[model samples]
Target: MKINIPETDQERIVIVGGGFGGLTLARKLAKSNYQIVLIDRNNFHQFQPLFYQVAMAGLEPSSILFPLRKTFHRYDNVYIRVAEVTGIKLAEKRLETSLGICNFDHLIIATGADTNFFGNQQIADKAIPMKSVSEALFLRNTILNDYEIALSTTDFDDRQGYIDIVIVGGGPTGVEVAGALAEMRKNVLPKDYPELDCSEIDIYLVQSSPQLLKGMSEAASEKALEFLTELGVKVILNNRVVSYDGEFVEMKDGSRIQSRKVIWAAGITGSLIPGLPEGSVTYGNRLKVNRYNEVEGVDNVYALGDIAYMEEEEYPQGHPQVAQVAIQQAKQLADNFKKRAAGKEMKEFSYRDLGSMATIGRRLAVVDLPNWKFQGTFAWFVWLFVHLFAILGSRNKLVVFINWVWNYLFYDQSLRLIIRTGAPWKKMDDVIDEGERG
Candidate 1:
């Protein structure tokens, strides 16, 4: 079954991917003359910034995700389709989706980014990436499964393999995951696994950069590193991960770390859909776009969010792959569409830097604004408020807030159920054997 959107004789604007950018554009274009058809792989729009919370069991996956149909219920011109966009036929102004072929007057590709394994198929197949809701649920399950395995095992080294969590990449996602895992070790694990020593649980954040939060200020980076260390996370800087064989992560320096849970938050590339000119893609696997966010050499096709790279004087290397940039670009593009329809002059898109912020744990965070930089409790509060307001649904906000408060006051995370749909014994055995050998 499909959610039918009324198609008027007006120009139909087809948006691929109901991520931050696409959703923002759709909301802005609500009640406009143009007909909007938004297609995504999933029906719900996810709040990606807080995915770590879902993985760490600090928040429910449903709390951070809202149904796309609910967001556009009031807009008669907007429609959402739960289908995977297979390829773009730019020459014919059509897109091939799982449902069928759909033609569009203007096509907007806002498919966002995916984890970049950098030509390593082994890592891609083995490591867990927290880029989507399903992936986060898998991580949550995997983490809980490790503890359950530890409870059953009598061997010390075998138990250590279950407890050791090596997070690849020291970026925001990595640091947040590390901090959350550290909190679990400090506050929750001891209570849950009293038979086993919680101290054996190791949380490591590995980064190739000289410091954590490379995109943020120095003070923020230092404060985050300090916070992570205080939480018992081993902060490894200027270190490169050469390989991982599902169980052991081997460093470039020839050192191997045994870990069953290796979360890959290292890098992300533009989630490119098929049918675009192969050479038109640029750095970070993004499609090269003109000033108006139009795909290079394609007139009717446009790209935004993490998939589009608009290299300007201010942003020579393209805008940072952040929600703010995506939302801002979408807003501008929506206005441009209106102006184009009215035969008015179009405006060149420019991004306003709203700065970056990351939360470490309860009461530990960092914020970098245009004129101000702060760390600690106030920054943490700022981080909380901003994210709460940014989330799509009021119910989602309430659920997340209550969960956060409960976690903060009690120092306990309750979502630790290991609900396995099917037995993955073969995969688990292979991972365990690999870890033992390493």
Candidate 2:
């Protein structure tokens, strides 16, 4: 059985993963040229950079998400489906999805990336990963509930375990989460949970590398470490989280950090699908594509975003798996497709990076632009502006802007309610009902 898409004379372009890249490409494409089918497991486009904020109780998931169907409401030719694409039947240009087979003349793989546990099943089973809306919600619930559990637990060790947090990875996500949690512990938690001693809640950021934010500049890294320290986040460098059997986080050197809540933001590998030629898959499970983003061995198949590994003049291995690169590539690909339809030569994709920035806490951020590198209050506002501007809708931008302003004026985040109860692994309805009852 097929996916039940209506037959159209126009060449169909089936794009996988409704991420930044796929969303941009679908919006940019002309409705008349191709029948666009965008398929993703979720029916919403998540602003992934802000998932940390959701986990930290600073923002609601819906505020950073845009409905996939609403994204192309005006375009009649664009069809969006919420389906998990299993693999590809390349022989007939067919996609094997959970629903059924989906045929396409051109296929775009934009499935993005997944959290990298590095073959640690123990850690994977116990740790929380902030990759999606649901995952973020689970984390928010788990973190808030941990404190509640701490307040009543008779055993001191178990109480400490409920309050303490071990954040793996010192990258942007890890740093941001650590900073946010520190902020909460300092400003939000004490007032909310007066019964418990919030001051004893230790937050540790663990990184195998010697420095935090390894991809950033030395100055930024140094400032981040200092900032995190000042905010009461114990930074543990040159140590790897070897295991976490639900109670303590074990280091490579045999030392153990006692914490039940472990946040895994250390690394990411590509969310690659099967059926592509072996040569096309590269390091991090990224797909090997030409400058045009066409798969090396697959005819009329292209990949984009975090999943597309194009080794260009500027990017030898591949472009950094960031939203900016994805957006730029999607626009270029759309332009190439439109030009091809107009009987003009297709243009090769080139990424124009705007730079990178990370927010540590209130009035604390680092920005590295092409010719400028700054930190502190000024950089914080820059980081806020860039993210606010990048958000999809005007209402969302307004909501986020007001929230940030309020947060800056008064050191608080009001969205800290744990409206989802029960263990993170429990049923959704049960969690919601428990929260309501509590």
Candidate 3:
């Protein structure tokens, strides 16, 4: 297959993955004399930070995603393709994509990370990961379906399994999900399923580390722990989940949580395309890159976002795999491309620490900035504003803000409908197969 991209006089730039880095880089190079081609598994740019809300039924998935072709409607030189890059043929200056082979002058890889199960096959086969819109919807459907099953089932122990949830990893994702489910239990579940005993429906957040939000300051971590405790989330710290067999999760300390649903947000590894030299990959399967974001052992090829591992004096291993780093790297690369076009010296990339924040629940959050550290209702507002501002489109922002308003006033999330039709909850393998097909 030809891949269908037309030949152009301008130097072609092929970017894989339409996540934060690819999108920003494409937009920056829109007017430049480069024929930009962006490809991804999905034809949408998703606001991933707000995905927890989608999973928890506070917001819809469509509100957080923007169509890729629609995003480049104004750019004559930009072309968007909905296809996965299977592998890179660096020697031929080409990409092996699902559609066909695509040759490029300069190829930039922004393929983001995926959920890391840490070599646990049982967990990988069972645990539901929250990395994309589909995964988020799968989680939402799973949770809602579990409740429906619980309400109808007569077996006491089986019913409890349906309601109990164990969310692994105490990072922002785990904390946010823990808080969201806690909110649902406190405010929504009781009203929805009055017959079911909400007290027995336990929500546990298990973290291997001693503190929550490891990368953040001690104050912020303690504050998050406190907030989650206040929300009735059983915070299990300093323990690793040894195994999960779909029915129960066992910890290293010989304790077990009886749960059917397990959310895995523990860690992430680079979603690397095959065929790259093994030496180019470092810890976490991330592509080792120079300060210029150029992938090691490769020419005219660069990487960005969580996939690129560039070690600096400040960051000995690599920069933190966050959206901010991806965006900043994209901007820097864009500026470098422009500089090269103007026959100027291309500068190296450096990351600017803009701080981090995590929302526990309503009026509960923690924010740590270089100059300021705060927690509580104000921090929650700050978290909301920062995320709202980071959303792709103004219309999306409006929709999310309105959803927040409605949910806040009514203490309810309206997107609780489970329209999914598929195999039984016991057949998670079937569900995974179905998701892959979709």
Candidate 4:
């Protein structure tokens, strides 16, 4: 059966994944003469930068996700569907989705990336990854459930194990999560669970590299380390996590950290679609695209966001899988489409380096802008403003800003209620496995 999109004489552009790239492109081409069909597993566009906050209970999930249909409300030519693209029929210009078949004159793959377990099935099966709203909610539930279990357990070691958290990777996500957990250990936990020894709640950040924030400025990295360290996070540098078994995290250096929760912020691999040319799949499972973001060896099939691997003279490898890169590429692609319709020359895409930022705790952050790098209070505010301003909807912005202020003033988060259907104190796979068996 075919998806029930209305038949239009104008060319149809099927965009798989309503992420940063796909959503941006659809909005950019709203006034164009083409019919746009946007598809995603979820109905909303998730603001990824705040996913760690959601996992750490610093922000609610709704504060970060905006409905795709709501976003394209006035755009009559745009259609939104909540469907997973299963396969691509390049010759037929059609997509096999969970709902039905979808035919398109042009296709844009912005499926983004998934957690990279690095070929370790054990780690992949056990470790929790904070990539989307549901995952973040799962992590939050797991953490809170662990503490509740800790309160009932008499054994000191087991209780410590229950509350302890080992976060792999010292990238922005890891650092932010560790910092938030440390803040909770200091402020919220003590007040909420007065009986438990909150001091025993350890937050470990393990990184394989010598420094955190590897791509950012050295000064920013140093400041981040300082901030996290001051927040009482045990930052382990130059060490790699080999495996996790939902009980203990084994490191490469023959050491093990006992923890009930393991957050996998180590890496991400592109979400590759089946039926694409095997040669087109490159390192990190990304699709090889040219300067114009067109997938090589495929006509009318393009890639954007984390899925596209484009190499330039300056960047021997692909450009960093950042939102700016995706947004810029989408803008360029949108312009190129218009240029094609206007019979004008299409321009090539070139990435302009806009620096990076990471916040460790309240009033502690590091920002590396193109011209300047800063840290501490100023950088923290800058980080807040940038992220707040970048959020999609005005209502979302206001809600998030109010939440931030409330958190800052109260030294507590309001959205800590563990709301789940059932399956208390269970890992992600265990829940899935139980469902499958039942």
Candidate 5:
């Protein structure tokens, strides 16, 4: 099938993935001379930084997502297609997606990254990774469902399996999740499940590295560790989770932790598209790009965000796969497009380090700005302000702020509800088959 985008006299720019990079680029160039086609698996743009908050039941998933069509309703040149890009026809300058084939004058790949299990099929089979809104919601459901099951179980060992959680990875995601779960364990669980001892619900954060938040400053990492420890999180450093089979988490050192849920926030690899030329990809499945974000050995095709590996003077390996890097690169590429339109020379992309921050829990956080490094209450507020400001919609900002204030005052998260639904991979036909079999 062929994609049904209207033919235009202007050049077409097809962007894959509605992530920070693609979304920013499309928004910046919506009024430009080029016809923009934005394709993604989901019809909405997800705020990944706040995904943990959704998983922890602190915020709703809809609060962090904005509709793509709504974003470009006024722009006549923009078209949004909800489909997965299967492959690229580099020779034809076309894209083969699940929906149809699309032709583009220029293409931008910003497909972002997926949870990396590091070639562990067993772990991949059982462990849950919070990479998207659906995954986050599934995690929330699994946790609440486990608690429901635990409330009815009289056996101690089985109850331990139901309640205990093992989070693998000490990065910002793992730290934030651990902190949020720790908060739930302390304040929410005791009141909700009065029949069971909430203290038995151990929250273990296993990090292969020596410190939490590895890329952040030493002071921030140490402070995060301290805050998590103070909140009764069992922070295990320098320990790798080798395998998990729905019951126990086996470590690299042959140690085992019996837990039903394993949150795999360990690592990420680029979401690579097939049919790319040989030697175009590098380590971690990222596309090798130049300073102009143009993919090597490919013309009129560029890469941005977590999937692009652009080596600069300071970052010899590549820029860090963060949202800021993606946004900055997108802005630069958008400007380059405008420059090309104006018959002006395009400029090279440069990254500005904005530093990093992670919140351990309420009133406990650490921030490392370029000029300032701090920990504690002020840092926590700063973290909240930055994230709140970054959310897409004004309604989302108000809802999240109210949720935070309510949680703070009452020590409760009202969103802890188990929403049962078909898994993303399960088709309607599969559900019908299962129902018929039953």
Candidate 6:
């Protein structure tokens, strides 16, 4: 089926995925002469960095999401489609998606990444991943439901299982989650569930690496560990999860932790579509791209964000899979497209390291810059300010700021209402099936 895009003499630039990278590219190309078609599985662009905040009830899901249509309403050159790309037919210069096949002159794959289970299907099925708004809300519902179940259960051991939270992979997500849970245990749980013994609720953060926040400096890692420990979270490093059977997680050292809730933040791999050469994928299932973000061996086909592995002299292994890299690459690609349209030589892509920061909890965060390193309350303030400014919509920023201030003053999460009607997986499957049937 032919897509209902506007008939234009300008070249059609198709971008798959509306995450940080795709949205940035689209916005940058808004003023250009190229006709742009942006497709994504979801209608909203999720601010993934604050997903834990939503799960922890610190922020609402709406605060971390911006409607795709709303974002591009003022741009006449761009069109938006809410559909999942199924495959890419390189020979035909077409993409097969949920809506239908659409031809494009240039294709940009910004499909981003998904939670990595590291080849463990059992863990993948059972563990909760925080990658999207729906997933975060589902986690929030499950956490509340588990607490309710804990309160209802007469057996002490069963209650412990319900209340205990185990977060695997002490990266930013895991650390933030553990810290949030610790805060809940210390401040919120006591007030909310007064009958339940908050002390019995355990929060454990398991890291396979030697230290938490391995991407950051040693000082940052050390500070993060200290912050988590001070919040009453147990940090277990140099250990890997061997298996999880829904009730307990077994470690490689023949140890085990009993918990019903397991949040997996261990790793991520590119979420790729079919029809690309199978061998083109590298480590982490990322598509290997050239200096100009063009897919290797496929002209007019490019990739960016977590899905693209562009090796450079400074980053021989490929750049870090962060939102900043994706945004920068997208902007660069947009500029290149404009330059090519004007019959100018295209510029090579180079990432600018703008530093990294991770917040542990209220008044606790770490920031790493080229010449500066800091931690604690000031870092936390910087983290908040940067994130607030980074969010797409003004309404989102205001809502998030209000929520953060409310959470700080009251020590309570107002949006902790369990809205799940049935089993989470069953509901998700039903939705997918409905879409297929439609």
In the range 1-438, model 1's lDDT, one tens digit per residue, is 223455579899999989999999988888689999999999999999989988888888899998989988787788788999888887788888888888899999999999999989988877889899878877887888788788988988778888899999998999999988988888898998898788888888999989999999999999999999999899889888888887688998888898877899999999999998887799989999988999997778889999999988989999999999889999999999989989999999988998899999879999999999999999999999999999888899898888888888999987887554344454666754543211
Error of 3 at 356 (Å): 0.2
Candidate 2 backbone collisions, by pair: none
How high a TM-score does candidate 3 get? 0.96
**Number of clashes in every candidate structure?**
0, 0, 0, 0, 0, 0
TM-scores of the models, in the order given:
0.95, 0.95, 0.96, 0.96, 0.96, 0.96
Per-residue lDDT of model 3, residues 1-438, tens digit only: 869998979999999999999999999999899999999999899999989999999999999998888778888999988898998887899999999999999999999999999999999988899999998988998898789878988898899898999999999999999999999999999999998989888999999989999999999999999999988999999999999998899999999888988999999999999989999999999999999999999899999999999988999989999999999999999999999999999999989999999999999999999999999999999998999999988899999999999999999999998756454443645664444211
Q: Provide the lDDT at 309 for model 5.
A: 98
Candidate 4 structure quality by residue, lDDT tens digits, 1-88: 9999998898999999888999999999888999999999999999999998887788888989999999777889999899988999
- Give the range where candidate 6 is weakest over 10 consecutive residues by summed lDDT: 429-438
lDDT of 6 by residue, 1-438 (tens): 866787689899999999999999999998999999999999999999999988887787888999999977788899999998999999999999888888899999999999999899999888888888888887887788788878989998888888998999998889989988898889888988999999999999999989999889888999999999999999999998989987898999999888988899999999999999976889899999988999997879999999999999999999999999999999999999999989999999999999999999889999998789999999999999999999989899899898888888988888877665444556534633432100
Pairs clashing within candidate 5: none
Off by more than 4 A, model 2: 421-438
Clashes of 3: 0
Q: Clashing pairs in model 4?
A: none
- Scored by CA lDDT, what does every candidate get? 0.88, 0.88, 0.92, 0.90, 0.93, 0.89
**Superposed model 3: Cα runs more than 4 Å off:** 421-438
Q: Clashing residue pairs in candidate 3, if any?
A: none
Model 4: worst 10 consecutive residues (lDDT sum): 429-438
Clashing pairs in 1: none
lDDT of 5 by residue, 313-347 (tens): 99999999999999999999999999999999999
